[model samples]
Target: MGNDKKSELEQWLEALCSDPFSSILDETVFRVDVFETETEYIVESELINCTKEQIFVTCENDALIIQVHENENINKQRVVHLPFPLLNKNIRAYFTSPILEIHISKEISANHPNRYMITIHEIDL
Candidate 1:
């Protein structure tokens, strides 16, 4: 009780209860960049302050769900499981500012060539 005799609201409640998870420890997951070239398959997300109706992109089973309605009591989801399976009617999305570029279109892009980088791995049966 002796931090200069406390009470500035008890030193702001001792600096907000001294980190009880530090406000959920920042970063509620939103940072992605799954690259590829020669024919597309690029999904980027930064979404500063977010918009485009609070953002929402989907592709289900072959994964690529990046939702962020941010209200109605906070709901921010992210998932990007794609090892192959893109070109759901040739996708394309762009949102300049803080980036949100998704341009997937490669079902067999003439048998892949330039840059060719699409590797997603996660296995845990």
Candidate 2:
């Protein structure tokens, strides 16, 4: 692509057709990392300028959903899909400033999916 500027029509079209978060965020601002260990799954997310109270996390079915609610209209959401199913119990989440880490125990999930909210605790680094 060239350095040419997009026309007004193109800009408007892009704005209208963009995804929910694409128009309001740079995507790179909220980076998410997901990995698996022998016994557990780990999800680390970069949530800058966010308060622990404003962040909501939930493990449902095969995905862990991370959401940062800046306000009613502006919010950031990311979903980390687990390689294998996980049970909500034995999950530990520690948040220190811009980094949020979630350690989820690997368990054979139930046939009926369950959704559980994860409480984030602040830890002194």
lDDT of each: 0.58, 0.72
Clashing pairs in 2: none
Worst 10 residues of 2 by lDDT: 16-25
Q: Candidate 2: deviation at residue 96, Å?
A: 0.4
Q: Please provide, for model 2 over 16-124, each residue's C-alpha lDDT reduced to its tens digit, 9 standing for 90 to 100.
A: 3365663344365477655557887677888999888888888887678888887654487877655455554477798999999998766643333477888899987
After superposition, candidate 2 runs with Cα above 4 Å error: 1-29, 72-74, 107-113
Backbone atom clashes (below 3 Å) for every candidate: 0, 0
lDDT of 2: 0.72
lDDT of 1: 0.58
TM-score of each: 0.26, 0.66
Runs of candidate 1 with Cα error greater than 4 angstroms are: 1-27, 31-44, 49-79, 86-95, 113-125
